[model samples]
Target: MADLVIADVTVNKKASVYFDGKCISHGVTFPDGTKKSVGVILPASLTFNTGAPEIMEIVDGACKVRLKGTEEWVAYAAGSEFKVPGDSSFDIEVSETVHYVCHFG
Candidate 1:
């Protein structure tokens, strides 16, 4: 069996939550450590607080990505992979929705 496991998502009052799966929280094992992630997006308008270094690929439709201190963000259509760092906050003006990945240590 794989020694490393993906822990079940938990709900705690002190932590900020985005929808459900996507969030910037602590590592399950390393409680004091920060673990940020972006699970799945919905058709609804979405705003993001930049969490960590991420690698995202467009699964369907389209999305607009931007960071706070950046000049501009790149847009992408389906089957596109975009990398977002876990530094500043950003917004996603999505057409249908965008599913991305994020990580921090």
Candidate 2:
């Protein structure tokens, strides 16, 4: 799949500085008030709780994710995506660098 280009947005460099700074991201906000973060996760295992529904697009590499209420972890590679419901927590295991773009809605 081709790369995504989101036009007319602002970036917040300080966003997504979690997991002892292992996962870093910059927040992107669009003209319509939509928000997302384009970031990369280094090899690590982390869990995140979402305030809103998140659609995580795997832009490069891959990661194994166990969504809220799921017992199995699923692998998502580049050009693939997954969703996590609002107010839910999910676990992600990255064996390699994984590039992702997370859309919050």
Best-performing candidate as measured by TM-score: 2
Across residues 1-105, which tens digit of lDDT does each residue of candidate 1 receive?
Answer: 212234554434453356563433322223545544434566555666655556554545677877667768678777676666677566677766555433453
Which residue pairs clash in candidate 2?
none
Worst 10 residues of 1 by lDDT: 21-30
Kindly give the number of clashing pairs for every candidate. 2, 0
Error of 1 at 65 (Å): 1.2
Give lDDT per model, in order. 0.55, 0.89
Model 2 ranges off by over 4 Å: none
RMSD of 2: 1.3
RMSD of each: 6.3, 1.3
Instruction: Give me the displacement of residue 81 in model 2, in angstroms.
Output: 0.3
For model 1, the stretches where C-alpha displacement exceeds 4 angstroms are 1-38, 71-73, 100-105
